[model samples]
Target: MYELTVVVTKVLGTCSSEVPMKPGDYLTVRNGALRIPEGGHICLYALQSLMPVLTTKERRIGEKHSDDWVWRVHHVQCPDPEGRVIFHIVRSGEKAEMPPYTPSEPCPQPQTDPSLADLRVIVEEVRGKCTSGMQPGDGFLLKSGRLYIPAGRHFCLYALQATLPLLPAKQRAPLDGDWLARDNHIICPDPAGNVVLRIERV
Candidate 1:
């Protein structure tokens, strides 16, 4: 798989994030995993907006051309009407290594650090139509890094993407005045959908 790097290219309006995001902030995707700088944060809403195209961008397609939509479309904007953070996706041309495990080998155990807390992500409200049919009470749990959606119910992938990046940060105890400590809510990137989710440490 191709390694992809997403950079914050511009901010058109005030960043409403607890920690204001600006240009030069970036994150990397390697082997389907995300890496952000230590002590740095990326807007959850911005990540949700990028979810639809990130997988496609991580492929080794043909050379760049004007006709190819994937080649031409490099920038994505967060769904926040007030704080439109623009992201530029760059195909780094680096190949990501796959996990070194065979089919016969069992899957690795989930990380269970004493400092990391379990979490619960709940649908707080739905102001508009939720395409996935998620309701205010729909929710899921993240324990030992494994996601557990209640049987017979589901969580929206788009909505979940908005909260994934922040779960690890929230699992740990926050530093003095850390923005992640202050913010526990994430809004789905769909402007019309307006799905709000609350993250709680358990």
Candidate 2:
């Protein structure tokens, strides 16, 4: 799926301009006629791509409804395709901040020996710091930028894809162990950034 970058905007007196928003902020449309999500703002890109039925409403309100677009936040039912929709907002500086990697050498090959102990790829440095670390048995945490896998927890290849709905078809692989890794980094398909999930041999 593709992403649409939408910056929040505000108006003071006669001037109107874009504004920064945090995760907790809410978004509305059609003069608060529709509330995108209660606590988390809906990712317009996801809403358009994943749920075909919802696209009409989003397009109508965002593009065709009215030019005024003076919306006030209100409570309304959110259309969740599978679960609650959570949007991840990363600044331009943060998206450009990639983890240090060796430029000359290629990425390490996946372990193939069955006799060797299975490596547990735990969530190491998510955006340079680990926020609530996910346990191995916790399965997959689907948050956009929050990295997972480094606590040496073994996860099935199928389980990893379940967390990343936006991952391109080309990147989907059936085998386990950092299948997303390239150039010494394993990147996940996040709306905000190509998040580097930790990959370590344990």
1-202, model 1: which lDDT tens digit per residue? Answer: 6777777777899876545567777666655445555334456567667887887787767766765788777889988889888888878863433222111122134443667787899999999998667789888776544455654556665677778888878888999989888898999877888999999987
Q: Considering only N, C-alpha and C atoms within 3 Å, which residue pairs clash in candidate 2?
A: 8-19, 120-152, 121-149, 121-150, 122-149, 122-150, 122-151, 123-149, 123-150
lDDT of 1: 0.71
lDDT of 2 by residue, 1-202 (tens): 1122222221112211011122233322221122223223323233332332222223324443345332221112223333333333222222422222211221134423323322223333334322223332333221222222323333322223333443332123334555444422354333232334443333
- For candidate 2, the TM-score is 0.20
- Model 1 scores worst on lDDT over the 10 consecutive residues at 98-107
Model 2 C-alpha lDDT versus the unseen true structure: 0.29
Regions of model 2 farther than 4 Å from truth: 1-114, 128-159, 162-184
* TM-scores, each model vs. reference: 0.49, 0.20
Cα RMSD of predicted structure 2: 18.4
